[model samples]
Structure formats: structure tokens, C-alpha cells
Target: MVDNQSREMAATDPSAELVRLINGYQISQALHVAATLGVADHLKDGSQPSDTLARACSAHPASLYRLLRALAAVGVFHEAEGRRFSLTPLGTCLTGDALGSRLDYARWVGTPGMWQSWGNLLHGIRTGEGAAGFTCAVEAWTYRDQHPEERAVFDAAMTALSRAEARAVTEAYDFGHFGCTVDVGGGEGHLLKAILLACPDARGILFDQPQVAVTAEGVFASAGLTQRCQVAAGNFFQAVPGAGDAYIMKAVLHDWDEGDATEILRSCRRVMPATATLLAIERVVGPPNQDPSGKSFDLNMLVQYGALERTAQEFQVLLNSSGFDLVGVIPTYSPLSIIVGRPAPAA
Candidate 1:
């Protein structure tokens, strides 16, 4: 009762929002702990006593009860009369077996590597270098490559995000006209699978690093696309597969700064046919004080990769410099937008 009164009082206070924002890490960490313990999965059946949940999760009963009640106060779970808890609508998204679930993403964000990098955000701002270099002694990609477990977690997180965004992207744009589509740096082929499923006639080429490309074979085979989709492995900075009617690089270019991003676009242009279209799926930063998600994502890029999300104008410049004309920017239901480009006319 006192807690509820305090909450109401805080809600009416002008500075309460700022205080909550400052303590946002508590919510994030709590969610991470719940996700890591598969709390939502266990709660999917029905409400259970906190002690039962703790026993199932191998957690301390008192500590787990405290965590669940806190999450309940935030609407992630529901607290009943005897310390029993049930999954709320928001909590359901954390279930590992659910389609488009954010389970892996929750796990990924709370990893020590990500925590350490974000913790050193001040260093990144001062030095104009990624915190990954300072914290892990390497760039983000190299750090993940060296840590196999972390790489797997990161890959799963990417795949989870792709699963959630795939339908939105496919619905926003048409790929049926293209005879062949190439997914550059497509991880685990979730987006590519969604595309092929939507456009039955369009064959696909899933391209990525050798180690990454191998994992997509199973994804394609399981999707019954092995005969129609070919998994190719190589470096995108050097070259991409040729003859694709449409080439897609989703969430790829944002990992690099201007120079390297331009080089990637150029590499795509070198192999792309005059008739082929280029699609860069990424978040476009919005005007000042708006689009908090995009702005925060830009900061994440800065901290982890020394990169920044581009605006529409910046995307146009990159495309033009890479011998392509910016065709259009297509928005989807998701945060990502498809920035379309086509080969420029000869001089």
C-alpha cells in the first residue's frame, strides 16, 4: 500500500520522469535477468508461486520474488494474491519459443561485452573511437569473432530481430518483379527466407563471411528453399555476387563510418548490373529531440562500431558517390527503412 502511494506521488511529481529515466538501467537489468532465466517460458502455462519459479530457475526464492514483483509493477508480469506471478502481454515477448521473440536480443544486450562497451561511452565521446577497442582491446566485430559464445549470442539476436522485422519489410516493398535477389551479409537468412516465401518465383543468393554463411544452409534447407537459394561465402568489401536483379544489405552499412560505408556501396556497384536495384535497409536518424529510438541506436553504433546512422540526405550522397541514383526511401512498420538506389546513367 505504501509502495502504491509512493508510485502515485512520484507519477504526479514533475521530476519523477527524469528520476525514472536515470534508473532505466534497473529495468533493463531486471528484464535481462528474467530473460536469462527463461522466466516467461515457465510462466506461459499459468501463474506460479515465486518459490516454484525460483526452484525451476535455480534462483534464490527471495531474490526471484523481488525481481518478479518489480517486473510486475512495470507491467511485465502480474502479481497475484500469494506472491504468484503470471506472464503479462509484454512478458510474452520474452518467451524463447515464440515467433518474433526478443529472448536472444535481451540476452545479447545484457552480455558483459555490451555492458562494458556502453559503460565506456564517455571514452568513446572523448576519443572518437569505439568503446569496444578500449574495453575489449579490439573492434566490435573482431571481439565477437574471438569470443565464439558471444558471437553465437549476437548472431541469434540478429536473427531474432530479422524475424520480427522481415514481414514488415517484405510488405513495404515488392520483390516479386525481381527474378533473383541477393542478400548481402544476410545472417541465418531469416529476412531472405521471408522474402522468398512472399515471392515464390524469386530465387535468392545468401552471401556473408565463410563462417557466417555456413549457418544459413540449415535455415534455407529447413525452409524448403535449398534448391532455390544458394548460400555463397566471401568478403563484401571486395566483391558481391553479380547478376542479381535486386541486392539487399540490411543492417550492414551502419556498422562502418562514411569511408568504409562508401567503399561497401562501391563494391556493390562494381558487380551490380545497370538494371539491378540496391536496397540498404537501415534506420534513418530523425530531427533533433525526436525519434529517441533512432538517436539512441546511433549512440549504440558510435559506442560499438564508431559508426552513425545516416539521414536521408546522407544516404543520397553515399549512393551518388557509389555510381548510383537514390530512387526512394520506403518506410515500413518497423524501425528500418528501405533506401532504394539504381545505377546512374553514364557520363
Candidate 2:
């Protein structure tokens, strides 16, 4: 299917893709702003005059209208009368009493450093590097270290993403068989806490970097899970504590490439008991458009990190290299699927 004419137009038309891509950032940024401002939450009943919203939010009326208008133009929200806007279907995804409300995640994405790193999409494609090191024009991890506020956003965003899935995963899996469970690279201990709450017999440990571990204290106490949950702080690159009868890592493996991902898995393998289970719950991509979120997130991984959301077969290969065998892939209520594997028995 060589379309000579279409190819020629695409080659010659410089503005076609770039225009949308550039403006697409604006759309995302606008959604972030609107979500942060609780614009959709206010419009849950119906549209109101722009001035009223501006006064409520302590923002300028004209500027507020401009932001709403721009968001409405993108179909995130809808406008009926002049300067009056409300939630669209897409906007509603950011609202309601849903577990994974986009509010926290939306705000997190617009946070300065996270937003700035995404601008390096071109760097990921051109250089094929994480572009993580360049954030400071000097040392790597500098941006994350220097900006604890942005890191808080990142933590909240991860928690926001895992919210609905955490509950879903907890219910979908039968943890009645396990004694202790460790969540490796578990951001803020949200998912593990969800699992432990669901299966009270299961004791949980949260393993993450020191900074993120600080957040677990609050989440644990708030959930009244302080008695059941243990928080451990360290890098998974070196080792993972082998304290659990089963290990679960949701949405963590996809953030790294094969080498690094394999390393983390191997570290888990080192810690996991011979009889323990390893679960990698991730967006298992299939044929194009068969699943929207998985496919879309595949590109997100490429553009943001130097990794990928992978297929089940791909997950198997990485797990195999790390001293585990693919056991099964379990589909849950969410877009993510669980890829289960377990290590060879110890002598």
C-alpha cells in the first residue's frame, strides 16, 4: 500500500504533525490547570458564568474564561452560552467519586519539573537516552533531589494512577495463600496497603527510595494499616529485601528498559523465597487499537522514559533472564494485566 501522493504531501507539509504536537502540549497543560483549579468539579451541576468561577478560584475573570474556552475547544469540557463551560465525557473522567480521579494526577503532570522533563520527548527519540541526566545541565537525579515538591507530585501521580487498580488488583487476586507480601518499588505504599486491607492475613512491606518511603508513614496511619505494613527505604538497583512470601510490582517494570528492568527483577529473585510468587502487573499491549490505554501508554513510555509498556511475551523474556519462569498472565478489571512468575526452588 504505497501511497505516493499521501507520502509526498506528508513530506512537504511541515506544519501538519508539528502543529498538532506543539498544540497538544498546550491541551495537556490546560487540562492540568483546569483539573487543578477544580473547574470540572464546580461545573458538575451545570455551567456557570466565568466571573463567578474566577471569584471562587481567586483568579482573573477574563483569563479564567480564556482557559475554559481553550479547554472546551479541545473537547475536554463543553461550552454552551458565552464564557460558560462544563464537563464533557473526557472531563468527567477527571471527576466523580471514582477511585482514580484525574485531579491529583492532572495536577502532578503540570508540576514544573515533570512538565519540563516531558519536553525532552525529542531527546528520547533523537538521542534514545532517558534525558534524565540532562535535567540539571550537570548531574543525574539532580532535578528529583532538588525539587521535593515536584517529587511529591510524582508520588501522588503514581498513587493516583494505581488507585482504582489497587483495589481491583486486591480483589482480583486470591491472596489467601500468602503469608507476607512485599511491593518492590511501591510508590508511597498505596497498592500494598490496598492489598493488605483486602486480605487482612497478608502482612505487607513497601520498598522504595528514602524520599518516597516518607510518604508511606502518613498513608499507612491514615488507612489504620500501620500495624500490618512495614516501610523499607533503599534502591532496588542494589538489592530488594527478601522478607515476603510473595512479591508484587505493579506499573514498575515498564519504567525501565530490558537491562535495568532485568536487574530489578533479578534483585527481586534474589530476595524472593523459592516458594514465593512474583507478579508484574502492567499494560500488556496487543494488536493495534485492541486496547487504547495500553497502546497510548506504550508511546508515553518511549517519549518520557527510555523504556516501554510491553507484551506478555516480552515480559516473559525479561522475567526469564532474572531467574523466574512465566506462570500466567491474569487480566483484571483495569487495563493492566498481571504477568506472574516464580523463581526456581532453593536447594
Candidate 3:
């Protein structure tokens, strides 16, 4: 009784596919563990026995061996012999050592902290309230503000991500025209440093809160930008440093509701000279049925911050309400597009 349905079912078994899907979570956890343990650094050039690797990382041999085997199967490492594994090119990069590594970002995103908040996404959808309750009953910034250990992890991941994004923003934008610039909410000043390196004549300001300014000093000193760039520890919601020709905010406005986003913009508007321009770098959500990054990020804002990504039309409305109008939008080399607006000339 070899029916066609029976034959097809036998040829394409479902168990393996289901198992692969079910175990995808383990891949994320394993990579997180690998990054935490510095396995990629150890395995960079060659292979090592599981027992030896465990000793180096100070973990149990059997537990470490299991993780290594799991990671190896997924192409992060190569199981060459009985218990020795070598780092594949993919594996070494998972250590957050690459030019544009998302390794630490992945770790932070998949950690229990963010994972549990995302677990409450349904609540966000139903109530229109964000997942602050699930995320330590605090906003993302507030969570980092309270927990020092978590803050360090978050800061490290953010710095890495910012550095990677900086290259694209620097190369894509024309900074030559601007004599001076300021990066608002520019944690660690990497973005400002990159912009300074790109625009030789441009001196700069890195205006962020007091806690953030401490981190900026280290970055500025490292980049030798302390002489050219002024790191001002202040609140952007209160005011922005009014000296720069151009004021920039990256991935900042989308975290706020439209009203708050406008307030922030208006603050910049208030501090600016009539000729000063504003550059807000954000993901411009395209039309519906377009599967762009902003679409998913919009929902992320919905769950995480009670915010949403804006279409260009939406941005125009906000800009006009804030006493500025969208002069034009520039597409940059990064995922972020530059929304260039200016204060009213005279009217």
C-alpha cells in the first residue's frame, strides 16, 4: 500500500527540520557563551583539545566540550580530530574583533535582560504600553542608569556598534562644508572623532549627559581629539551647545514619541543660529509592503519605547511643527539616512 502521500512523507521527514528550528535558540546562547569566554581569541590560529580549552577558560571540560561541539556543527568552528576544534573565519569574528562586528551587540540583544522584555511583546501590542515593566521596570536608558554591570555590557556593545556605523557615515556624508559640528547624545565620542578625522578643519563638540561625558574623555584622549573637540557634559533635552554650524543626532529621535521627539528637535531649534542646520540621522520607514529595516525597528520602538519609525511625510509634519521644515533628506552609506532641516530664515 505505497500511496503517493505515504511515499512523499517518507522521502521528506519532518523531524529533522523541526529539531533544527527548535534548537536555533541554542545557537544564540552558545555564541554568547563563546564571546564571554574569549573562545574565539584562543581558537584564532589553530585547534585545541576541549580539555585544554576548558583549562584556559577555567570552565568544566565536559560542559565546555559540549558547547564547542555544538558551535562547531554550526560552522563557527571546525572539529578536525577527536576533541580538537579550530576557529573558522566566522568563529573568530563572533568575538567582537571584526571591523564591523555585531558580536557584543548579539550578546546584549540575546541576553536574558532583553529577551524577557521581548517575551512581553504581546503585552505591548495589546495595551499600547511599552515593555519597560518586563525590562527591569525601566526604560533602556534607565535600566543602564541603575545597573552598573548591565550598563558596562550595554556601553561596550554600543561603542562597538557606533564605531562600525561611523565608517559608513563618515565616508557617505559631505562634512567638508561644515566648519564645526556637534554630536548630541554622542556617547564615547567615536562618531565625532570619525567626523573630525574626515573633516580636517572641523572642530567639534560632543554634548551628552554627565555620566556619558566620563566615557567620552577616554575616547577623545585615545583619538587625540581632546585638542580639537570640546566634550561638554550636559543634557540635550535641556539645550544643545550652540556653537557648531551643524548639529547631529544619530538613532536618537526614534526612541521618543512624536511629541517628545519634537521637543528634542525644538530644543535644538531654540539653541541654533538662523543659519545653523540640523541633521537627524534615522531610518526612514518606506511605504507599506516594503520590508525595510525601519519597519521592524518601528515595531521595536512600539514595544521598547512607545515610539515608531517615521515616514518622510511624518518627519516633515514634525519638523514643521517644531519650527523647522525638511529642506531635503540625504541617503547615507549607512542604514541611517540624514534628515537635513533648518530653522526658519525670517518668516
Candidate 4:
């Protein structure tokens, strides 16, 4: 006879998994609410009665208890005696003070702009245009530019994301050889700071738009790299800093379609010494039925920016068009990969 566990597994309803997948948004929104209310931060010390948490969060006592109980059911928090709740290991990721905290990313996902764009994903699929442009009547970047509050949240989200990946990227690749590393479109300089920290002998140029690059000074200062790093403000489409031994564009090219991406690369090429190396740090889409995370990110890119995550072959083609020869793709512990390239031979 089959064992009890095997029988139970066999008896499970197939539709149950589909139902959970369909209701995934509920969990996302719940996590967003907790992050916004700083619930995880409050629970960092120890378990507290739901009413106490409610007061701390300025939320309705009974309602907060319900939310806590629900999150407990989902393994985000552990509900104890007397309706007290404590953060589970999974929940610690929502704490703002924690290393690799995803608080800002959760907040960004629940922001109005992101919700509106994803809600209109069908429109993008049907029209071959970004849902953000269709729904917001402006491109996503322009929308953020118009709303300072949203822009701040978006920037924090990007920095949080970069912080989570920076260590893995640095560990997977060696940057010690390059004397000067220029991070093209490096917002807030998280990755550059990490690289500088890892390679004590190397200096860096943090380059981005004026508004974005200006905020990186504090990041460098906090890392004690103020003297070694220079913040350069400019548009990557127009120009990038020159005289760097290595150039990095992390999570940058995926924000644009092929034409715009190639132009950005060409701008870096225009100034890069033939000896300098270029690294495009991004997700390399895997073959069919694999790399689900990358494939899902590709869909989000379509909805939000009318762009995509590329396959290895696509990256090679893109590099060739932009005056670079593909060297090799280096994998990191994280989902992102380092696509190494060099300037094509002079014709």
C-alpha cells in the first residue's frame, strides 16, 4: 500500500496550485502593506501583542490582528499565544534595517504607477506598446520625473536591488586589475561602492543623469570612498565618462528597446579606449521552460518599458551592432550575469 504522505500528495487537487498562483497578488499587496507600515521593523525585537503592534503602526487593533493572523498563515510571521506576532525568517527580508532588505522593492511594487502598468498588461500584449505609456499617457521614466515622491521611492527601490546583487557580482568577477572603473548609469553608486570596497586599489567614476548622479555623493561618502570616486552627471545616450579601464552598465540596457540600447552602448564605445573592457550586467534569458524568473522579468519589461531581457545570442548581436565584440558571459550567484565585451577591431 502507498504511504500516508504519498497518498495525501496524490489526492491533492491540481487546481489548488493554480488558485494560489492566481491569488499571488493578494500576498504581494499584503507584503506591501506590512512594508509600508514598518511592521517588520517593529517586530524585529520580539513578538508583540497584535494590539500593541496596531498602536505602534497606528492601525485598527482588530484589523491589524486579522492582517497579522493572515500573514502568519502564510509563514511571514509566527502567531503566538495571546495574538502576539513575531517575524519569521522570510519576514526579516521586509525589515528596512536588515542587510539585503527588500522593503523598498515591496513598496515600489505596490506604488500606483507599477500597479497601473501591470494591470494594463493585456494592453501591451495586444498593442506591442508599453502599458505604462498607454495608461499613464507618458513614458514610465517621464512619469517618475514628473512625480518627485514616486521618483524617490523608485530610486530607493533600485538602490536596494543593487545592494542585494552588488556583492554577488563583485565576488563572481575580478575588478582588482582595472585602475579606473566607470559605472555608466549607476544610480546611487551601490555597485560601484561595492567594487571600490572589494578592489581597494581601484578608483571609480559613478556616471548617471545630473539629478540621479548628485544623490550618489552621500553613498560614496558613507563608504569612505569620497576621495577615490568621482560622480559624473550626463546622459548615457549622449556621452559617458572617458579614460576608464573598465565600464559597467548594470540593469541599464534592459530598460530600453534594441535601438536605444545600441545607442547607449555606442556612446560608451565612442569614449572607451580600445583596450578598455565593457560589462553589461543583466539577466540572460534561458531556453524555453527554464529561467522562469528571467522570463517573468522580461514580461514586466514589456509592460513597463517596451523592452526585454535578452538571450546570449541576442546579447552578442546587440554588442556587434554597437561596435563591440562579445567576449564571454560570466555568471554570478545572483540572477544577473556579466556579459563581457571589447571594442571591435578598427576597420
| Cα lDDT, all candidates | 0.92, 0.80, 0.82, 0.93
TM-score sort, best first: 1, 4, 3, 2
Q: Go through the candidates in order and give the C-alpha RMSD of each one to the true structure.
A: 1.6, 5.5, 4.1, 2.7
Off by over 4 Å in 1: 1-9
Q: Indicate the TM-score of model 1.
A: 0.96
Q: Candidate 2 at residue 161, lDDT?
A: 78
Task: List the candidate numbers ranked by lDDT, top first.
Answer: 4, 1, 3, 2
Assess every candidate by TM-score: 0.96, 0.83, 0.85, 0.94
Candidate 1 has which clashing residue pairs, if any?
none
> Which pairs clash in model 2?
none
Model 2: residues with Cα > 4 Å off, grouped in runs: 1-23, 44-46, 73-75, 93-98, 135-141, 288-292, 345-347
Q: For residue 251, give model 3's deviation from the true position in Å.
A: 1.6
Tens digit per residue, CA lDDT, model 4, 31-140: 88888899999998999999999999999999888888888989999998999899998899899978888899998988888988999999999988999999899999
Task: Write model 1 residue lDDT over 21-111, tens digit each, in one string.
Answer: 9999898889889999999999999999999999999999999999999999999999999999998889999999886798888888888
- In angstroms, how far off is 145's CA in candidate 2? 2.7
lDDT of 2 by residue, 107-188 (tens): 8778766676677767867877664544445322466568877766665666677788887787778876888888898887
Give the C-alpha lDDT of model 2. Answer: 0.80
lDDT of 2 at 264: 91
